[model samples]
Target: MGDYLKKACCLLFALTTLAAASPVFAADVLHIQPKQHDCGLVDEGVPATMTAVVENVSGRDVHVSSVKTN
Candidate 1:
């Protein structure tokens, strides 16, 4: 069906544009050391602190607004 094909093309284009506009697509511009870390044998209710190195290799100025921990 011609109408169905036209709709499918439009949907694909919209999805592609959405992906390109997302910040997740630009994540590769930064290099983060120690992508994963292990804090071993931590007691409950105690705080643990770790440091991560972030480098910008994208040849463009990048501002890091925040950092999150899990």
Candidate 2:
């Protein structure tokens, strides 16, 4: 009984401290738009330019570290 009560109190205090000290991170919203282009066919030894327009609607600074395709 006493052990359980002590554990619960310690857990509660730890949670409260963490919540008060931690900073709330806001979500970042970004919009990506691609330009229109016409390509007849994709074949070997073909050159293409991929253009994208990225917009930050979150009103915050966004860092683009890297980009990859699957």
lDDT of 2 at 5: 100
TM-score of each: 0.41, 0.35
Predicted candidate 2 versus true structure: per-residue lDDT over 12-55, tens digit per residue: 99999888766443222444445454555667888654555555
Task: State the displacement of the C-alpha of residue 21, model 1, in Å, after optimal TM-score superposition.
Answer: 5.0
How well does model 2 score by local distance difference test? 0.65
- Whole-model lDDT, model 1: 0.74
**In model 1, what is the error at residue 41, expressed in angstroms?**
8.8
